[model samples]
Target chain A: MSTDLSVPVFTNQSEEELGGKWGMVIDQDLCTGCQACVAACSMENNIPFVGETDAAYGRSIQWIRIERFWQGSFPEVKMTPYQPMMCQQCHNAPCEPVCPVFASVHSASEDINLQVYNRCVGTRYCANNCPYQVRVFNWRDYADARVRPELVTLQNQLNPDVTVRRRGVMEKCTFCIQRIRHTEDVAKSEGREIRDGEVVPACAQACPADAIIFGRIDDPNSRVSQAGLASRGYHQLEELNLLPRVTYLKGESNNGSNG
Target chain B: MIKKFFDALNQPLGRVGLLIAALVVLSGAVWGIAQAQKPPEQPIQFPHKLHVGLGIQCLYCHPGALRGPSPGLPTESKCWGCHQQLQRFADPTTPWPTELQKLRDYVQQGKPIQWIPVAQVPDFVHFVHRPHIAAGLNCETCHGDVSKMTVYENPQVINMGWCLNCHRAKTEDNSQNNPTNDPAVSAMLAEKRTKLTDCSTCHY
Candidate 1:
């Protein structure tokens, strides 16, 4: 309520320890980039179908997507690395600032960026500020009963844990916060901490190659923290020192020439 | 005259006046009716005071509350479970109470008692009962002193602001590890504070 407009950067250790830092380690060597994670993320998160023309206009809303890059252009084709890119969940998330309505803020407890759909005034400042470009803006009334009648019938299929965002609100991957809270509540009721691999995000669970590893990085024994220490472990835009929680191991070798 | 009417709207004070008038009408008619001004009509005059006075636990009838999202209205069969015993214990000369007889008739006809929900958050809100109960919040915290009420009255204005206020209060108490709460529970309670304010925590 105070006039103080400071946005928390999710650095305070005590807060983070209580809620814990949620980090992901993607083993590029194990990832085949089958796009299963992408598909699963879309379904679980209720990502929109912008259609061909809208997508061509660069309006596709994919929280987690398979980004493919062809390395070489010759007869001796080089390795094509398939990376699963989503919200980096940076500890020093740049997108937290520049929100006029304070919609985009750091979850001090969880150490992840959260965008409150109801609070968002749709200035798209968060989207512009995001270095990862993962934030999606709803330009029109798409998810409502007015535009998509089939969605009205399929409304029951929508995850009860996630709210179907209305128009003019910005939204993105929350690391399936609903799932995290659910597990956290359940674990607390049972009087125990959430076990590793017990609470998996939609994308991580659907990964056939087991490339995506999500766990509490605070725990030294957790898969994410352990895999993050791998020799090839690196982060996107590492020079910027955004301190992205997603650690990616370098993928090398094995090119199946489909040509 | 028509031009003067439009000119009046152009002035800031005039606009403010119109807004005030609109708000008064809106608050008087819509907001007044929607909230606590008038208690909702119930299908049955089930008195909480009588049951609570007789030493019946709130959890006994609201068993689902301890386990799940909803504290459902007691089913007719559940009522019958106790009422049958109560009838057997009553003196043979004394006739059954009218309400009890009505309940018996309903059970015999296989009709359920349609007790209107006293506390209801919107469909979008996933207000599960167990977590609050687990966090040591009794039914009275939100529902008020239901044990004293004949008809369930929503004493607290159940709104987002009301929810946030309580959450902030708890957060302040737990954030620094208050001596009152259990050390382990204090940490969990503090952690829960962050989630409580999160829009997705309830809205989702």
Candidate 2:
């Protein structure tokens, strides 16, 4: 009998996840960095707009961002691909312990880091503690009369399932806990367990390249586990051992640029 | 004394503590008086006692309970459906009731009934009536006994804690088992139990 030792298994939240852990696997080679995931995540999560001035002052509220690394010096400069950076949802999350209000705790069921906006007291400790720099602080009350009327009109299109966070709060990627909850509710209503590919966060759903894959890593047959088992699978800042649920697959370099 | 009182009120740190205490007392008094007063004035007099006494199920008028997120107000046509034939009175020549006549005027004008909601949840809350209805709860669970009310008023205050109590308590009770043999409903009952305590269950 043949055996595969490379399968990454994780378990969390559902009754079916007896030993399950939720994780994600991203293929960098296939991603064009069009930023569909970034746009979709903001819309789905109801992330407030900080406007041009605040954005210029390094206060943009983008939950998922594309970090561009420019490789090489002057004459032979090249764009070393776009790395989509969001909350890692780490197993040994640095932000979890730092929270004074217990807002940034590891969700025992889903195996993901969660930030409850109601519980957050805006200490900025979680933001400082996060090695990936994915957490963002709500500097201003962006949803109310503080913003331009036109922008407030834009805010009307916010997702009803996610909170429009008030000022003095810290927020980050929750792996779309609302979506996770809704799907689980629907599934449990029907007398079945959550399927392998059933739960996909907004970022994974929006990517046109099909680069971002999110699923239960505990299931050996899941796409995320399969991708993690592949040769190119690697963790960012592995030495820090944050144990992030997000795993990146090395993209194939184009035209002999940096790998 | 007035000058000293003014000075005390003007002090920022001390003023806040006093102001909050005064506001709390003032608001609580205002709220108590308001609740003590008569019920809200509606465009039309919709007496739940008369309607419910006629053997009308709550779902007949507020059909959104099982189907949608809210127990929505009945449409104008639903009221008109009964009132159009209510032309004949005990005297056989008496015109419709004054309130019924106003209802007829609106229906004939092609205007919708803008019924004022009695139980209004805050904007931050996304309360849905479906799960509560599915849990085999009657209209009286959150909405006190409406059949006994002549004038509709909020009998119970609906806050996060009020909802949390039911959501947390129902799992242990499990008294509201769905009669349907459908597999999905059973799954929902199983899955929805733990999710009741989740924040996004109502807030999101």
Candidate 3:
């Protein structure tokens, strides 16, 4: 029997060739490693506070984390610029393939990797497969008020736009798909295209230094596209050929000699 | 004990008892599912038929449907706004209906009516009503004909399959649907189909 070529299949094509819809640019030079983005992301996404014990064990469900490296050694030691790490929204995400349930699937329309909570069977295969190590699994019912009595009062602040994920589901940065969808809906209702800087993710919005930029990367006029074109701009782990949507601008090292 | 249990299954009378027990469990499961599907009892048992028949638009009660995800329930004042002005409630000699009395009590007590939503999708499904309404869908399309019923009920099970069915139908390319056969229109429809079918569109 002849193969039906009309049927759609997943391809490992690079996002640069396909042109991603949503993209982010984080300026490492401007980031202060304050962790505001992490806090904002948790509140906006309804990510539970896994407590000190779980967090110490590396069970904290932070969608965005700041990575700080040390520059030089001993006497001349200095802190390197802070780099914010998150799900790169890769066009050919490594996590997408390993999910047997297809819970970690790519959205063709949005061009972003999605973690379908209801579909996830807690296999944690996607988390292990991810090169970025951005995916966090719900080790317990952290958001459930019945399990966590203190969360009952905090539940009032939960964002209704984003789903409160339960135990066993592996989740990661969605690039604020809810905000993107809301902006798209509003733009559609007004019979216009989404304007530049119209859809900002929680991390980008909460950045005090204005280090993070988010917008349609396909549009050359967008802020994210312009930032991505900077000479210092580079993707984390670019050698992997994941085609990460996040572009990080290199920051100048502050060695002791500079002081 | 295990061998004795197996031995009892060998007898005809024991087999009949086992069959009866299995049937009871199967019927109980079926009944449980049916009970879950039944419409939940609302606090007011608000008469949709009378209000809809009176020519009041659905948007008047649920203005949020046109603007956001939730179609907010009308406040007690909104209900009292019309009820207090009504000729039936105006006359001291006439008594208010039980449902209207509940509304008056709520308004007087300064408490909000805790309305139980009928057509609700799970938390994972981020359903927004504005887009559906903007797509030229009438109130009765998904919510059924409120004009005919007293209490609101779902027209169909609000599941992924039901949603996908409508999305597929709307996005499908048909000669009858698109008589002009314009390339630009077809391209737009194709793009829309992708957006509508994409998992992230509904489930964030």
Candidate 4:
């Protein structure tokens, strides 16, 4: 038997990590659509609110929205709720190729489809390219006098790291990039690897059902990757071939159980 | 001849008038740029030097800084924690700062301070100071040097790319830089090839 004295060390760096495949696995069985995640995400990322008029017209600037659809009618009616919709962070993102500016681009480091707000000139080419209708346009200044009166007061309380967007621009989800960065920074500073339950977003942290699972796609043992592999897990609008990073599990039938 | 007559007709006076108009436009542009760059001032003169430099943690007055969306404004009772005694020595007649006096007046009359916030993050972004603190980031990372400042000053420009860059750098898997050694990344990675690119992570 040949004895090897030197121990091999695995570094976080790898060539395969350059092109990211970021995706999410949401357990429909666990989802209640309580809107806590929606509120939490909005507060964390600084999403502007549309008053009664805009909300009535479906013009709200929600980076992630809960999409509810009715499958059947009357006697067999089923109203299923799908939540946390934003850019899918697609692999062959249609939004990416069309942008006049490089505002919408896929990140090489991770599978994240990034929307660089400062680079955006509000041409809204990315919005037209998206198949999921995840992109939102800001029609009016959220700071207008009629909107949330407490909004200005609320602004000062924001996480100083994130930007507060102005009106007349297109903005969407960056997957809590601030939190992800903060967690990664913490992990890096300690000279250790990023572990589970440490990089939770506001919505995931606030989620009562633990419906949302977040992690690196490369780790085979990660909860998100396993959930992605589940039999019921599937992507939204899969036929479009946008290759969304977010995955959803089929809603469990509550039938036969005591209602 | 005729060409010279037309050239003189549109001559030095016309050029001088155009130059004067251009100067007016340029000055107006300068004023507009200056106005846009100016940060709005807050209502009260709340000094961090008087509070934090004397060994006050952020949580002491703004108790909700850890639990919820905001580091809420302190109540009159919270001010009384120190001022009940300190007031007699500093200014027995005026009591603590006028803001605290106003808070006491509100409490007596059953009202709350109509405080105007100094740091304004737009409505779309969600930021939790608690998680950062829990993750071991100092309160000073985003807040700037609070301990050294006499009064709060708007010193940072938190644009979108700024946030994305920080997030990108932090998430870059640098073993030399990680501070808290949070386990969620590996747990997220272990179950599968985990990628942090869900829209729900930041926007909803």
Identify the leading candidate in terms of lDDT.
3
lDDT per residue as tens, model 3, A1-259 = 2655685586866666689889999988889899999999998999899998899999999899999878777998777788899999987799987899999999989899999999999999998999989999999999898988977898889899989999989999999999999999999999999999999899999999999999999998898999899877888888888888999887445221111
Among all windows of 10 consecutive residues in model 1 chain B, the one with the lowest summed lDDT is: B172-181
Candidates in order: C-alpha RMSD to true structure:
6.0, 8.1, 2.9, 10.5
- Per-residue C-alpha lDDT of model 1 across residues A34-128, encoded as one tens digit per residue: 88988888788777776677778888888987777666778866655677788888776788768878788877667788888778889998899
Which ranking of candidates, highest lDDT first? 3, 1, 2, 4
Worst 10 residues of 4 chain A by lDDT: A250-259
Which parts of model 3 have CA positions greater than 4 angstroms off?
A1-15, A251-259
Model 4 lDDT tens row, B126-157? 55555556657676777788877755665677
> Which wins on lDDT, candidate 1 or candidate 4?
1
Q: Judging by TM-score, tell me the better candidate of 2 and 3.
A: 3
Return the TM-score for each candidate structure: 0.77, 0.77, 0.94, 0.57
DockQ values per model: 0.34, 0.26, 0.88, 0.10
In terms of TM-score, the best-performing candidate is: 3
Report the C-alpha lDDT of model 2 over A12-84, residue by residue, as the tens digit.
4443334347788888777899999999999999887788888999989988998877767998998765778
